[model samples]
Every structure is written in structure tokens, then in C-alpha cells.
Target chain A: MSATDAEIYATRSFTETEVPMIELKGVSRRFAKKLDVAAKLARKLGADVKEEVVHAVDHVDLRVRKGEVVGLVGESGCGKSTLGRIVAGILPQSEGQVLWNGQDVATLPGEAARTAKLRRQMIFQDPYASLNPRMRVADIVGEAPQVHGLIKRGGFDEYVDEQMRRAGLDPAFKRRYPHQFSGGQRQRIGIARALAVQPEFIVCDEAVAALDVSIQAQILNLFMRLRRELDLTYLFISHDLGVVEHLSDRVVIMYLGRVVEEAPTERVFTAANHPYTRSLLDSVPRIGNRKRAFATVKGEIPSPLNPPSGCHFHPRCPLAFDRCKVEVPKLKAVDSLHRSACHLNDRA
Target chain B: MSAPTLEVRNLCTHFFTRAGVVKAVDDVSFTVDRGKVLGLVGESGSGKTVTGFSIMGLVDAPGRIVSGSILFQGKDLATLSEEEMRHLRGNRIAMIFQDPMMTLNPVLRIDTQMIETVLAHEKVSEDEARQRSRDALGMVGIPSPDERLKSYPHQFSGGMRQRVAIAIALLHRPELIVADEPTTALDVTIQGQILAEVQKLCATTGTAMIWITHDLSVVAGLADDIAVMYAGKVVEYGDVGEVLDKPLHPYTHGLIGSVPSRNKRGEPLRQIPGMTPSLLNLPEGCAFRARCPRAQADCVQRPELREWLPARLARCHHPHREEAAAA
Candidate 1:
């Protein structure tokens, strides 16, 4: 079955069953830098050189229900993008499993595997880099449907036309190349391409970060509209908290490759349970309120190669204590749904 | 009132590209009194940076200040020769760029760069210059200025690097400092700290400043006055509170409303439709008319920036005061 049909079927199934559309169980990925075998062997003999292993995504557990937009937020090297890639099945997890429709994506075979591929898609951060410069907008937008044979062989143009219309692009502009379109229009094409597959879940990795402030709003609204129209689920990853608060139904705040806090969007913004989340919230500049002093986190984000000892944020957390430095705090529920991995959750 | 320290009169800067002569800055005019911060705000390619560069006599070949005069302390800066302008550059006017590395050299130590900037403008002893550099670094909130001064640019974090760059700019204590989005790359806390230091410095030393940025929120907190730029023209100019609280131009209204902070949660963000017109092929009339909701037949004739009220200037034939009051 195609992604659109599967989405329709899932909506009907969801009316009776309560299974989440996607679930990630302790997914972690580590990448090793390229090195010669001789150099690797020499390093084992204490040759004053060490092989580097980047623990990009470390033991993240998350779940997204049907029609929910969950935001994954963190700084540049905090592994948010890596986790998004793992969830999209674009990169394999070194440890743990990904469940799509309660079936393990790693173990699925044939039609089930194909269905998993069609059910999820990703919208990359850079619209310019994501679209092919040499190809026409029609070919770029219709490639997914054409490759999957969802649309008939000769119906590529019509398929592209319909997707463009759905994405708020003029059909006549489909003949033009990606370079011919503006940044906002090009992002619309990227969204159209993702929607062409009719995926149940989409990972928007900093989707609007590259656009200007005004263009960013337009693109964000388009995403909101598409979510309502298609009943799609979104894993919105961004560094900007304002955008996250505007888009997310639930938010997962990450730091140094670990999920520090996860809560409903409104609660996370109003009464944050984690110090990092609080600091991130305070960092955003507001218009009317003048007296709110921003809490600038001291110390740079530690390199993932050598993260802080216990809680990764202990080095920079204002409320960090000796216990925070000695022992790792597992994510625990502070309330019914809000979860945070900080030792001082109850303390003022 | 004391004579305005920096008075700009009908400044126009144009770029001679292969396609045509692009009017990057058109008849822009504003004044900054001593010890005051005037913010120049606009989106990318809106020519805010070019205005700063033009005031510093930094506009190069194919791009020139076509008309108008830049009068700093009653002297015309546009008429100065290359040699005379070079002497005035770091001595009376200095600029802090968006990227700290643009002002700081990666190979040189922080102390070397800062000390040299001091010596470049004045005949000072090495020890005196070093002391001044240390003071400048300390002024910007870089902890342990002595130790930090010994390190290279790469040794510091991005925020710290920007601080070091800002410290270098402060070494000379110029009459005017043109900061072009210097803190846009910084985290809000660092940006706040820098903003505080910049404001304090301006107040203490009677230094006039032009802070160019795309973020209106930052300007709202820092600047005394603001000029909103669009398509290389000042769309609105007024006191910061007046301009922000009651923006008089359609472009200014769209910009202030479009920011994510201004809207409520869950609502679709308010956006000005259409992208900024390409400078290479600018429209003949009001540059914003193509995207403006209230465009009229009069908008086809380019409107000149005229004083709409006391110390308030707008380039719209029909400004937003009446609509704003009604709303």
C-alpha cells in the first residue's frame, strides 16, 4: 500500500487502537573517524595518539502519537539532528530499536520494510542544498512518487502539479529549476517533495532556520496547515525555542546527546522542570517585558568526545551540586507527564 | 541642545553591477547626538550594513556614495582624501563586524591585535597600550583579562571571541562606533552583556553609535532612536519607543509583527508576504509596494522620506499613524 492509503488506514485503526505512530527505544549511534589499520594498531601500543569516537546520539527514548508534532531542541552539536536521522531510518542505530506501527523497522522485510520507508520522510534544514540545482522543480517534487510507482509512469507531471498546488505553489512554476525560486518558494518545493511521499511522520530538521524572519513565518504557517490537512505527525527539530513553542504539541529538550527534559509544550514553557530548559527559555528576547534578565549559561557546550562526568549539564548548570557531579540522573517523572533528568527538580 | 555629533544629510549609495546601477542606499538621512545609540534595522540585503560602511568611507570600487554629505562634528567626511580618511578611520570612527574573526586575526594573540589597534591610532607606549587593551577586555566581561590577552582568537569560544573583537574596537575609544550585527551570532545572555557595556560606554565617553541589526527586539532594548530600512531606504525613523510602539511604515509594521516573539502561541505566525525585491532589479516605485497590502496608485511614484512629526520621518505617502490609532 502507498503512504497515503496507509495513513488513511492508520487513522481508521487509531480510532480503535491507541498505539503511537512511531516509537524510539534507547536509540544511540556512534561514528568512528577514518584511520589506517597500522595507525589503529599503533594507537593500541600507547603511541601517544587516540582514536576518536563521536557519541552523537546516546540512549534516547521517545514516542510520537498520531497527529502530534514533537519538537527536538538542542544546540549545534547536541545530537538532535543525529537522533532525527535515526528516527527517519536514514541512519542505522548502533544500539536499540525503532518501532514503526509497533513493528521493529530493523527486522521488517519486503512490503513491511517498504511501507516503513514510505511512512516516514525528512525535510532538511537547507532548502537550497536539499533541492537539486540541475533538475526542474517538477522532477524534484515528483521523484519520490515516481520512484515508488505510486503515480502511473506517465503521470509524473500531473503528480508534480497536484503536489505543488497542495504546497501553495503555482503549477506553471513547476517547469522552472530550484534556483529560479526564492528561498520561501524553494522551501515550499521541499515540503511538496516530502508530502509527495504522503508520509505519516515527517522530520523537519531546522526547516525554517535558513529563511528570513518574515519568510520563516510563512513557511511555519505552511507546515501547520499541512499538518491539519493531512493529519500528519511531525518531529520538529530546532535550536530556536520560540519556534518550538509555536509549533510543538510536546517538546523534548536534549543536551550533550541525552534527553534532559520532556513535557507538554505549554508546561515546558510556563514551568520548566530542567535548568537547561529554563535557561533556554530565558535566553529568548521578548518584546514588552523589559526587566526579565537572561540567564546566560556559563562555559561552552562541552565536546561530545569528552562530555561532563555525571549530568552532562552539571558543568554549566547554576543549580548543580556535588551529587550532580558524582552520579548520573536518569529521566524520571516529576509530574504525571513531565519528565526531567535533574537532581534538583523539587528544589527552588 | 548640543550640536548633533554626527549629522547625515541625504546620503545615497549605489552599486554599479553588470545588470544596472543598484541604489543600495537612497537619500537616507539621520543624526546621532553624542552618547546616544541609533539603531539601523532591516532584513538581509536591506543595505543597513552598506550605510555603516558608507559612513566609515569603506565603500569601494563599483559601489560609491553617489550623493549627500556625511558631516561628523560639522566636517564633511565625504570630501576627505584616502590618506586623510585612513587617519580618521580608527581614530574617530571604528566598526565592529558580525563575525569577530573579520576584525581579529586568527594567527595573532588577542593582546597583539588589541595593542596594535591602540598604537595604530595614537602614539602610545607598548606597556600603556597593553594596559589599555587589558582594560578594554575587562570592560566587556571577559574574565581574567590578563590570561585571556595572551591567548589567540581560536583559544576563545565564539562568544568570547566576539568579546575580544569588541574589546579591540573599544581600545581606541572612537567618537563613533558602527556595530553591524556584531552580536547576532551570540547567545542572548552574551548579547545582553555586550549591549549593556556598549550602552554604558556610549554614555560615559559621549560616544555616538549606530547599531545595525535585523532584530528589532534587540534595538528596542538598546537604542534611543531607530531607523527602519527596506530596499536600501529608511522607511521609518523616530525615537525607539515611538517607532516600535507605533511604527509608521507598512514594512516596519510587517517586520515588527512577523517576529515569533510578538505573536501568541499556536497561532500561525504573522508574515509579510513575498520576499525582498532583488537589488539587481529593483522596482521603480516604492520598493515595498509589491508586497504591501495597502498599495495605491500614489505608491507608484517613489515617496521621499519626509518628517511626519517632531523627530519622526517616514517614506510612505500614507503613513500608518491613522490606521494605528484606529486599531
Candidate 2:
């Protein structure tokens, strides 16, 4: 495809009734411990060594419509980042299919696959780590587009300047390296780089987690402004519920590789169905909840390598019972627009 | 109210670097009474952490407490010898770092570390130390403390490891604890659990705490009083509720306004323009002047921290008045 074709495809609008911008059908990703030669030799000698497999993303299904902001909320080991990677097409799912615009990405032709790859971009959590120290800001933001044939070589500097300006960075400082910029400025550089690719979907994996509160607000505003200007769909992954509630149109709560609740943002915050979701909402330290004693879930998050047999959250769940420990609850619709994976939902 | 547990007066801990003198914690002050929690809050380079380190007598060479009186129950900690401070370090006073791994010896078992902490300050048998270690673990809400005691620090999860660190800090029933962002690295749910334990411990044991952190929400729910630090100085100090609800200083106002929940959804947040100024070779007068929306010509003169309301102090020439805040 030519540059104009890519531009046309990037700017193509879709109604909410149409196919989702991205969809995950029964997606599951597993990470297994690889045995080295020594470990293999020990295993052959009848040592009590076993390969451990971690189900990072268990048969999860999701759909994000065009221009929708889907907030994926989870704790440290909940596999939200893995799921986001799969959705961004940077990582492949061990099972099931990742559909882009109603077409399975695995089976797409050469040019179509490349286009799909280019259409999705990611903004990482740590700005200091994600960016290369050696590269100047102009090259960092301009390289991908030039390499991908999105811009002509002569128009490179102009394109980089435009992207930087859109991301709220001074293009005059584009000659400086990443180390010279502040954390928030480096994040804007990352944003500028992602926008340089002209992506329709952006996966922000804790993009503002490293910055200060005031800087966080500045970056969050830039994101909203970019969304308004470019009509972008975002998969915002964060552990902070307040940020998720502020940006997301819909919220999906994950616990130990499984999504426990999915609902409209307002519904998830107000009338959450899953016990884990309720616990998470309660656990968030809010400015309004001043001098309030926090209500914590009972135990630590279980090891994903040896997750609970039935529900992953059952061990720490306060309302867990015999059924929760013995049955793997299915994600079912609890309301017209809300879905929850909990045994209590069956009874209700 | 009887001779507050820790009263930091006119603290100035500066780093004498070759580049220049970096005033990390200059003229900072706060008071934490017994059983009360004081939150020292700021962004990075705001000198909150330096203040905590100064109070603990942990400021190494090249960084010295230039001027200050850290009155701990009528004793000035700044004047103490290294050997004397060593005695008070973990016995009567304790410090909790941000990373649990910093406190926990990875090669040793949890029991060994806790027992060593107990034995360091007291003449107790190994069995008695072990018993105290087990009790401390149990007190921090670690389930099956006996089993957990035998496990290595790596065997425990992040939250559990932090609990072990906190339990070690509590071994001597330290009269004062200086916790520098202890829960900043944990998940929110885990942080909530840890904060709950700390709150309960402070309430029941009457152990004064100075919780230094960059998060306002965490401080709001945990601290009885708060000191807002900016450019190595206390910009505002007052009761937690008053400081959060009716912030007098523009820096505090901007900080509060920038929270995600405070703004209308999908709209632009009220952001304080420009990043935090560099500590080394800082501009004259207010360090926050460049970012303050209410900054004017008068802001060029450094404002002293003075009482604006009853029990409230702010360091700003043109503070946000009550009438102005109402309007």
C-alpha cells in the first residue's frame, strides 16, 4: 500500500454498531519454564523437577469498538500487560485468535498484516527505559514512519516537528537525547513516536505510572486531546482505578489472568458485580475517603504458576465458598452491558 | 501533647557536591506527636525523602545536616555521635525504606533477620528472640507466622516481604518510625492492607510515625497532619483535612487540582505548567514560582513559612485566601 492508502485506512471511520476495532476470542497465553542442560540432566536422573507453566492470560474474550477507551485494571501479576501486548499484535497468543477489524490477524496476507501491525502502536510504562539513550528525540520520533514508508525522506523533519507539537513537546529540543529530557517530556516523545506511525489503536501500558501527580495530569490531558484530534482507540492498562475511571468508557477488571468483571465505566464503579472488582474499588485510596480505614482482600495474590484450581481469586476472596473453590465460573452477562465471572452470578 | 515525639526545627540538610550545594532539605519543620502520623509529601526532588533521612541520622558524608535541631523527646538527634545514633537507630527509633529488599537480607531466613533485629538491642536467648520474631510477624497480619518465619525473603511475595520488613521495624516497639514511601512499590490492594496495619499499630502502640510519600491520596487517608514540601522546604503544613480541603499555598492547590478525580472526566486536567526545578543551583526565592499560577513580582522574595490560619502554616507571599478559595 502507498502512503495515501495507509492514510485513508487510518482515517476510516466506523460506527459503534460495526465490527470492533480489535477483538480477542478465547485468547490464552502461557509461559513455561525452560529447562537448561543441567536441569535436563537432573530430570533424566530422576530428580523431582517439573516444568512449571504459568497461565498468564486464560481464555479471555474482549471487544473494543472504534474510538472506545477500554481500561484494563489489575494488580502486579494479573497478566493485563500480556493481554495488552497480544491486542497490540506485538505478542502472539498461545491459543485462540486475535481479530483486527473482524479479520483474524494470523491469516492476513503480507501487506494487510504489515498494515495491521502499523495500525496498532504501544506507549510503554517507563519512559526512561523504553527510549534509547543514544538516539536523538527527532530520530526517535521520526525513524519508524520513515522506515515504514509513511513519510518521504525530505518531509521527515517537518513530520517529526508536527508530531512533537501535537504531543505538547517543543520541537526545538528535538536534537537533544532522551537523557536530557524530564520524565514527562520523555513520555511526550514516546507519544510523538507512536503518533508518527499514524496508528488507529494505541496500547498504553501504565504510560503515566512513573510521573508525578501534576505531570501525570499533564500527560493525561495530552492523551485526551490526542484522542479528540485523531479519533484514536485506546487500551489503557493501569492499576490506579481513579485514572481508569477518568479515561475509560468501559472498564475490565482482571484477577490472576482472568477477567472477573467487564462493564460500563460508571456501572463498574457504582454497581460492580464481581467480588474481586468490589474489593478493588474499595481498596483504591481516594481523596474523598479521608481518614477511612482501608478494607483489604484477605490474602496475597496467589502465585500465577500455581493458581487456584477453580477461580484464581477464590483464595483471597472474602465470599468464596465450596462452589467458588471447585468450579471455574464462566463470564456471563450480569446486566445488558455488564458481564461478570463469579459463581454468585449464577445464583443471582 | 506532652513534648511531641519528634519535632524537626529549622532543618537544613544540604549536599556539598562539586557542582554546587544542593539544598535537599532546607529549613523544613514538622511535629509528630505520640500515636499521631505526620505525612511529608512532595514530588521527586522536593526533598521529602531527604528530610526523612536527616531525622534518622542516615545522611552520609558529602550530605550533612548543616543546621537543624531534631528534638526527639528533648534530645537533639543531630548532635548525637555515630555510636550513640546507632543505639537509637533500631532500638528506640526505626526506619522503613521503600523497597523491602533493601531491609531484608536475601541470603538469610525471615526468622534469622527478625531475631537478629531483636537481639541487636536486647540481651535475649535465641529461643526468646525467635518467639518475639514470630509475634511480630503475626502482629503485621502475616498468616501462619511460624511457617513464614522459616522461609527466605525471596520465598515471600512483595507484600509479604514488606510485612516482614515492617515486623522487623516493630521488634523493639520503636517509639518513633520514619517510613519513607514504604507502600509506594506495592499494588493498591496490598498497599491498602499495609496502611491498615500501620494505622492500627500507631493507634494502639502510641508509636509516632512520619510517613514520607509522593501520593496525596495515601497521605490523606493515613496522616493526621501533613507538610507539603517543595524545593527542600515546607511550603504548607496543617491538619490533614485542612491542608487537603483548603490548601492555602498555590503549590498545594495545584497539586490537589491535578488529581485525576478532581477534574471533570474527558476534559483537560488542571495541570501546573513546567516540571519541578532542579535542586542544584535553584532560582532565587520560591522554587515553585515558575509553576505557580498566582506567581507575581512579589514572589521573587522568598516567603517564610508563617501561620495563615489557626494551626496552619504556608510559605507563599500571596497565598490562596479563604475568600479567594470560596470565589
Candidate 3:
């Protein structure tokens, strides 16, 4: 069946009209590398040492409607994870506003703030590292709900078991520690824990990246199933384009700390407008397309500490011009649902 | 074809741990001809890495090559001494690890490492070694080889460091190179560049390579032959095009099906059920029987790796019929 036949849920048709579950407006996250005493002394002695700041996420604007799955794609240190964290509310944005259901999250009252925090949950890449080894699966899944008083009195066991079953885990194995279970099983436990809190939105940062092909498929299937059953929205961050293409309704391409392109999954894959996106699509090795010469983006990803002058991808872009080095390209609309950042687009 | 660059026959590398004997690479064998690339594909703990280590004679401590002969151009590497192996290790048989840092020394300049590698392998002058090192760096697509050669390992990016490691592996123009996921840690764009360089290197130099990785798409594109390992054994082996297009073994079929691009988007992937069994105390007979959909009672008798079809070999009691595979 074609991907366009995605009719398990009717959410996609009315997505544009619905109030976005989460919205990011010009969000930016910066991390400052403080100079040590020795470096500070060296600076005073004319050693050219100075404090540096990494703009992890810079002026990114995004919106995820209820039940929408938006895939965030980028190379390592490109700020996809940082963007996900900002959306999840775990890491506060260095600048800009985060609106939850058309309400500012930062200025929300005590009860509303608490609700907002619990409603948006995150699933990390490494299942082994994300979970608590000391705690049993039962406690890991149920603790948040219990602590938050979401569970009915004396019904904790049944509640945790239901969550486990929903995530396709055998509830009988709930008493086992994280080390006892395999990688896929541990990911399921993490999903169960997220669902236990009744989250409306989930931020999965390279969730299935560490899994083997067969196991990655199983986990991706689980994510799809959960979305259909729970009507959940997702900001799925991943480096694997194939996985992103399979699940995401919309795809957002990031470079350094900026949003370079955003479009429907099919458009992003078939007719990518951004040079970076096009190069990324070309680089993906295809099964059956054997012995073909790989078309690569020219250079290594410039260090995020001091990104390129204008377009972050300019250094590696094949069609890079003098204008690309001096002026940052704005993410302008190419189609009703498609947007791209490239000087070539303006020239055209 | 030049006595086949490397022929591994019935190789078994096991670890004698306190708990039990873990047969990491059990009765695995494959042949790589001159200028041919053999892709060793498997999931974690499938012994693909161990097989690479076995060929390089790098397995140490509890892990040892218990049986089988690694014939490198008619010479038996399995029977070779540490001294003899060392002489051939960096000179003739080179290895590029998953992490570049594992191959590169962080403290030393790139030149010192590359120059020393040349001096250890051959009677070459310092100037000649340094020039060869510079040329090798440029060969792997690294720009300004002279400047890069002076920089420390930490100065280069992840992709550049990996390129440097590959250049070191190519320093002696080794007859055989064992690359264990050399590009796995690199970005997709960088990975593409590296793959292209390696592909061209093999074709031009006739340098046989054994590439060990878990990504099927990569293997499908780059390898001439493919070996699919499961639970420390090679369950399937054949030409890359033939094996991936119409796999004879159930494990190979499932693995090819599991790739996201192969499946219809939004549908559940054709995944194999159950996890890989532990190497220690592995079940008798087929290690994949528990997860194989076509497994039968005959699977109880350990299946031999025999010819299932023309040029295709699989360890299975009941290999998938040609008709079924075509469908």
C-alpha cells in the first residue's frame, strides 16, 4: 500500500485547523564554555584564549498539531536533540516562547505548568542508559504516575500492568531489572513509562537508532501503533532518513542550529528543494541500487562552535555562491506545506 | 583468481569466560578474491567483529582462535606466530576499527604515527615515509595533507579522523584490509565520501577487503559478496545482488525485509521474532530456529552450510524454495 493511504486515523485531514499541541517561536538554546583559571590567565597574558558559546538551537520555529508526527533530521551536533529537549520542556530555551495548546508554557500557573510538564515526555536513544538499573520495570513504569497521583488508590499494580501490555511487553516480566531485558524490551519499558503518565506529546530523540534492523522495525511499529491508539503528537528526532520517512507526516531538516527545510515526508524525499536536503537524500545507500557512485556533500560538517558565516551548509553545498557566504537564507515557503532556506530559491 | 586473497575455512573463535565457553565466531568461512569486497553483515553479538579480529590475530586474553585455517594467499594465518603475524599485520594485513581513536594515538602528531607505521613495516627513509603518508592522506580525500599530517588526532573532526585512520591502513598498500564498520560512526554525507574512496581504491589497487557492518543497504551497494551471520554463525552467503534480491535462507530473507526502504511506508516491518541467543550455552542445532518462521522438526539436527542454489550457500535444513523467494 502507498503511504498516502495512511487512514488508520482521521487526524491528518483536519490537522491544519486544529490548535497545535506544541508550538515553538524563534526558539534558541546556547551553551557557554567558560574559560578556566589557567585560560583566563593566558587570555590576560595575550594568549588569544577566550570563552566560547555554542548555539545549539538558533531561531527555530516549529508547530506540531495534535496527532502529527514531525521528524527532525540532522547530522550529529546539529541541534536536533536540543530542539527536542526544548519542546519537551526539560531544558529551558535560552530565548523565545514555547506555546502549549495556544498557551505560553513559561507563564502558566502552578497547576497548569505541572500539567504541561507531565503532558510532554521524552524517549531517549539509548534504552540501556535512559532507564534506571536499580529499579524494577514495575517501579520504572508506575513511579511517575504514582508520584504525580494519577493512579487511583490501591490500583498501582493493575495500572502498571495495563501500560506494559499496551506497550507490547509481557506484564509478568515487570519485576525484572533493566539489565535483565534486551535492548528492544528496554525501549518498550521506556514507552510504557511515557504512556503511564498519559502524555499527549512525546519527543523521541534517536529512539530506535541503537536497535538492529529487525528490532528497529519492531520499535517503529510500536511507535506508529501508539500514535493511532492514543492520538499522540510526536517530534521524532533521528539521523536515519529511512526511518524518518516511514513514520513522519512532516520532515524538518536542520543544519548547525537552523531549520533549513520543512515539508511533507513524500515531498522532502522526492523533491527536496534545499541543497543540504538534496545532498542528504543522495547520500542514503539504497538496497538494490548496487555499485552506484555515491554523490557526497563536499566537506565535513563545520564545527558548531564556529559555524559558517551565513548558511551553515554553504561550505559543503555544491552550488554555493558568494551571496551564500555573506547573507543567511531565510526559510521561505516554496509550497503550501513546503518551506526551504536557500539563496538559489530566491535567484530562481 | 590469484589464489583467492583470503580463504577462511571452518573458523571458530571462542572466549573461555568464568561462566562458560562463548563461541563468538563458530565454524564461519568465506573467501575474498583479489579486488573483491566481501561484506560480513550481522546484528550485535553475531560474531562479525570477532571474525575480523580473528583474521588480524587481534583476539586476546580469554578469547582465542580454537580451530579453522585463515589462508591468506596460501599462507596459514591461524598457524602463524605472533612475531610473524606482527610482520604481516600492519604491512600486508591492515585493519580499520569502528572508532578512529582506537587506531590513532591522541597524543602524537598524525605524521609520527603514519611515519612510524611505515618504518616498522619496510626499510623506508623518513622523507619517503612522510611523502607516502601525505599522498595516502590525499588519496582518502583529505585536503591539505601536509597541514593535516602535522595536526594531532583531536584537531580533526570525526570524519577526518576516520579518514586519517583509513589512510594509515593504506600506508603500506596492504594486500588485504579488514574494515570493521569504519564509517558507522561518521555522518551520512561523510560516509558516502569514504565509501566512494574505498570502492575506487579496491578497483584500482586490486586490494581485497572484508567489510564488517550491520547496515544491509551499505553492504548491498558496496560488496561483491555478502555473508549474513546470526548467533555467531554465517547463516547465509552468496553474491550480494543474488542474496539480497532472492535470499535462500529464512534469516537472510527476514533481514532484507527488515530494512525500512524495502517495506511499504506506515506498515509493520517483516521482522524476525525473538532476540539473538547468548553465545554461552547456546541451544543445540539451528541457533535461529526459535526465530525462524520456516523452522521445522528437522532443524533439531544442526544444518550444514551447503549449496542451496547456484553460488548460494545457507545453513538450513529447509531453505526457502526458489518459487517462494521469487514471489
Share of reference contacts found in each model: 0.41, 0.71, 0.65
User: Which residue segments of model 1 deviate by more than 4 Å?
Assistant: A1-17, A34-44, A290-295, A346-348, B188-193, B196-200, B203-206, B323-327
CAPRI class of candidate 1: acceptable
Best by DockQ: 3
Error of 3 at A238 (Å): 0.2
Q: For model 2, what is the error of residue A188's alpha carbon versus the real structure, in angstroms, after optimal superposition?
A: 0.6
Clashes of 3: 0
In candidate 2, which residue ranges exceed 4 Å CA deviation?
A: A1-17, A42-49, B323-327
**How would the docking of model 2 be graded?**
medium
| DockQ of each candidate relative to the true complex | 0.45, 0.56, 0.68
Tell me how far the alpha carbon of residue A205 in candidate 2 is from the true structure, in angstroms, after superposition.
0.2
Candidate 1: tens digits of C-alpha lDDT, residues B116-139: 888988898999999999998888
Report how large a share of the reference interface contacts model 2 reproduces: 0.71
Per-residue lDDT tens digits for candidate 2, residues A257-333, read: 99989887778888999999998888888886688788887788888998998988888888888998888999997
Worst 10 residues of 1 chain B by lDDT: B187-196
TM-score of chain B of each: 0.96, 0.98, 0.98
lDDT of 3 by residue, A147-184 (tens): 99999999999999999999999999988999999999
Q: Which ten residues in a row have the lowest lDDT in candidate 2 chain A?
A: A1-10
Indicate whether candidate 1 or candidate 3 has the larger lDDT.
3
Alpha-carbon lDDT, every model: 0.85, 0.90, 0.91
